[model samples]
Target: MKIHLRSSLLCIGLLVLTACQSTSSPSQNNSAKPHEIAALFNQSTPEYKPETEANRTDKNIDSDITSDSKPIVYDDLWQEVIANLAFDIVPTPRLQKRIDWYLKQPDYLLKVNKRAKPYLFHITQKIKQKGLPMDMVLLPFVESDFRPKVHSSQSAVGIWQLMDSTAYHFGVTTDEWYDGRQDVLASTDAALDYLVYLYQRFNGDWLHALAAYNTGEGRVKKAIRQSKKQGKQGYFWQLKLPSETADYVPKLLALSYLLQAKHPKFKVPKLPNYALTSEVDFAQRFDFSVLASLTGVSKNQLHRLNPGYLQHQSAPEGPHKILLPLTEKQLWQSEFFQRYFSQTYTVVKNDTFYGLARRFNTSVNTLMALNNKQTTLLKVGEVLKIKKAQPLDNLMLEYQVSPYLAQEEKKPVLTMEHEYIIQNGDSLWEISKQFNVPVKDLLTWNNLKSSSLLKPGKKLVLHLPRPAKTPKKPEPKKFLSELEQLVKPNTSP
Candidate 1:
C-alpha cells in the first residue's frame, strides 16, 4: 500500500515537472520579447526543487516515521495505548502486512478506534487484573473490528465474537428477552474468563491459547497430539491447524506491532481508561417503554448502550440494571422513579386499542406487541396490560414466573397448529427462539433434516406438543411370572 502511494506521488511529480519545463524552458522563451527575456533573466528563474524526505516514502519500510523504540507523540487514545503497551512478542513480516493494510485505511481504523473508547479501559483493566498478554487488549479489533452488535454467519455476537454456545458456557445468558453475549460488561467478563481458562489449559503458552480461543481448545489439543506423534511438541507454529486459525495469531501480533509504531497516521482519542458511569437498579422487572417515558432516555439510545437486551424491555426479574448517562444520574433516579408505575386497566365500552394508545402516548403497534394481542378487538371487562412495573403494584410477582414458561405450563394453550413461511436471513435457531419452541421440535414437525438450510418463503409446518392425560385405571405390572399366571398355571416353566 505504501509503495502504491509513493508511486502515484512520483508520477504526479514527474507530470508537474514536465509541464513546468515545457512552459518555462529557454527554448520556449524564444517567442518572448526582449523585455520579457530581460525580466526572466533578471528575476533569476525559480529553481525546481527535488522531492524531499517529508513528501517521500521508503516504499519497503511502508512508513515515513521509523523505529518502534522511540516515544510516539500523537495525543490520542491510541498514542497513550502505544506509550503503555507491554508485550512479549515482536513484529514479523505477517504483522507488517496487517499494519500496512490498517495504515491504508486511516479512516476505518480511526472510526473503529473511536468506537472502542468506551470498552478499551474496561477490557485492558480486566486483562491486566488477570496478567494476560498485552496483545489481548487488541483482540476485539480482530474479532469484530470493535463493532459491538455486529454478528457473523457463524452466529457469533458482539466485539468478542462469542458464539451462543460459548457465551452460554461462560454463563452469559441468552434467551428471548436478552443476549448477554452482546452486552459490553457481560461479554467482556465472559471473554476474559474464557481467555484465562485457555491460557491455563495450554500450560501458559499464550500462542496456543490464542489459537485455541479462535479454533477451539479441542482442535488445538488434537493438533498438538498429532505433532507429538512426529516427535514434535508444545510448538504452536508447528501444528497444522485450520487456515484461519493459523492466521489469527499473526493478525493480532501485526496489530500490536502497528500500534507500537513511532509514527502513526492518525491520532487516537485521549479517553480516560475509566469513565464515570451511573447504574439504575430496578427492584423488579421493569417495562422499558415506561422506563423511557420516566427517564427521558430514548429506546434507540438504550439499544445502542445496551445491546445485550434482546427485547426492548429488560428482563422481568429483580436485580436487572440499566446504565444511564452519568451526567443525568441524579435526575433519572429522583424524577423517573417518582413518576413510574405499573398498572393494568379493564377494557370498557367505546375503549379501543387506538384510544388506549393515545392515552398512553404510545403507538397501536407497540401496544399489540407488548400485550401479544392481534387485531383491534377489545372485549368489555377484559383486562389489558396498559403499563408494567407500576411503582404501586406487586412488581415482585410480575417477574417471578416467565410468561414463556407459564404459557407452556398451561396445557392446550395453543388452539391450532399453523404453517409459517420462512423469511430471508431466517435461521432455525432464531426462529425457534422467536416462537419459543425448540429447534429439534421445529425440525421434527417439518420432517426436515437437522442440516437443512431454510429457504425463503418455504412453508414449514409447526405442530405444538399435546397435553398429557391421566390414566383411567392402574395398569397390571405384568412380567414373565404374571404372563405365566395368565397362561396355564406355569406348567411350561
Candidate 2:
C-alpha cells in the first residue's frame, strides 16, 4: 500500500512537470510559474516522511549500540562520518574529474580541515538528528570552503552561502548590527531547515534538493520538466541544468565517495568527534570585550566564534547568544560573572522610558521592573541599570578580527554634498532632524537666512555623512616614470 501511494505521487509529480513544460513558451520567463508548481507540491504531499518503526530504526546500529548497551566510541569525527555515509554513486568521468581536481591539490583538504574543525562535529550531529544522509554535512566544503565569513559575488554570505532573501525566508536575521547568516549555529539551523524543505518539495530526491540549493528549486524544477518533455527520466543527471549547478551535485557526490572509500591518495585530517565549541546564552545584550575579559578568552577567538556580531558588542536586538569554547562554558554561567558584567546607562535630557526602551532595544516594562518604578516617567541625570553595553574602542582593536568586522570597526566617517529637493509639508527643523544636522547648519549650507521661506520642489544643498565604504585594495598600476623606463632603458652606469 505504501509503495502504491509513493508511485501515485511520483506519477502526479511527473505529470505536473511535463504539463508545465508543455504550456510554457521558450520566451516566457514568468518567475511565478515555478513557485506556483512548488506551492502545488506543498499542498498535495506531506511535508515530512511519516514516522514508522522500520524507517525510525537507526541506520548506524553497529556503532551506536552494543551488547552492554554502551555506544561504541570513535576518536575521530571523519571515521564516524565514514561509518554513516548513506549515498552510493557510480564513478563517472564528471565525478572522477572532481576527485582528480582534489587529488591534485594535496593541501586543499588540510586547509578545509583546519577551517572545518571548529564546526564539523556540531554540523554532523545535527545531520544525524535529522536522519539525513551524512553527505549533507560536507555541503559547506563545496559552498564556501568552510569559511563562515565568506561572501559570494551574488551577495550570498557564510559557510552555507545563503542569499539575503533565502536567509530571511528561513528565519536567519540580517541587520546593521547582526547577520545570522554568518553565525554558525544560526546559519546551520536555517540551512538544514531549507534543505529538509527542498527534500520534501522534490519528492524525497536528495540530488534534486542539492541541485535546487545551488541554482534554486524553481530552476531545478524547470530543468526537470524540460527533461521530461524530451522523453528523459528527468533525474538529476538527465536534466539540463546550469553549468555550475550541473557540477554542484557531482562535486558533492565525488567528495562523499572519496571520503567513504578512504582513497589511498587522499588523506582525511583528524578531528575529534566531540564538539569544540558550545553556545552561551545571555539574558541581555553583552559586550564582547567584557566577555573576553571575564572569560579570559582572546578577542580574536571570540570574534572567530561569534562573527555574526558586526561590532564589538552583541546586537542591540539579539539572539543574545555567543559560541564559545566548551571549556569556558562553566565560567560564563557563573552567577558572579553575570553580576560583574551588568551595565548602567545615565538618563539625559528629554529621555523617557519609552525612548530608552527603543534606544537600548529593550522593553519599558523590563526597565521599570529593573528600576522599581511605578510609572514611565524618569528623572534627568538618573542612573538606570541596563543590560546593553556600549563597545569600547580600545578593546575593539586589541586583537585582529575577521575582514568584515574589521572593516566595520575601521570604517571612515566622511561628509558628502547632497542636493535635497524640498518636499510638501517640509519644515527646517524637520529637515534638520531627518538629515541629523542642526537647523543652523542646514541654513548655512543652503545659503539661506533664518527667515527664508521654503518652497516645494526647490533644491537645497546639504552636506550629509556618507555611508561606510568597504575598504578595497588599491589596483596595481605602473607610473608614467616606470612606463618611460620600460619604453627606453638607461645605458649609463
Highest TM-score model number: 2
lDDT of 2 by residue, 383-417 (tens): 99876333323323333555655554543233334
Worst 10 residues of 1 by lDDT: 1-10
Model 1 lDDT tens row, 40-107: 21222122212210111112111233333343343354555565454433445645666676677656
Per-candidate count of clashing residue pairs (backbone under 3 Å): 8, 0
Local accuracy by lDDT, each model: 0.57, 0.65
lDDT of 2 at 352: 90
lDDT of 2: 0.65
Q: In model 2, which regions exceed 4 Å deviation?
A: 1-71, 328-493
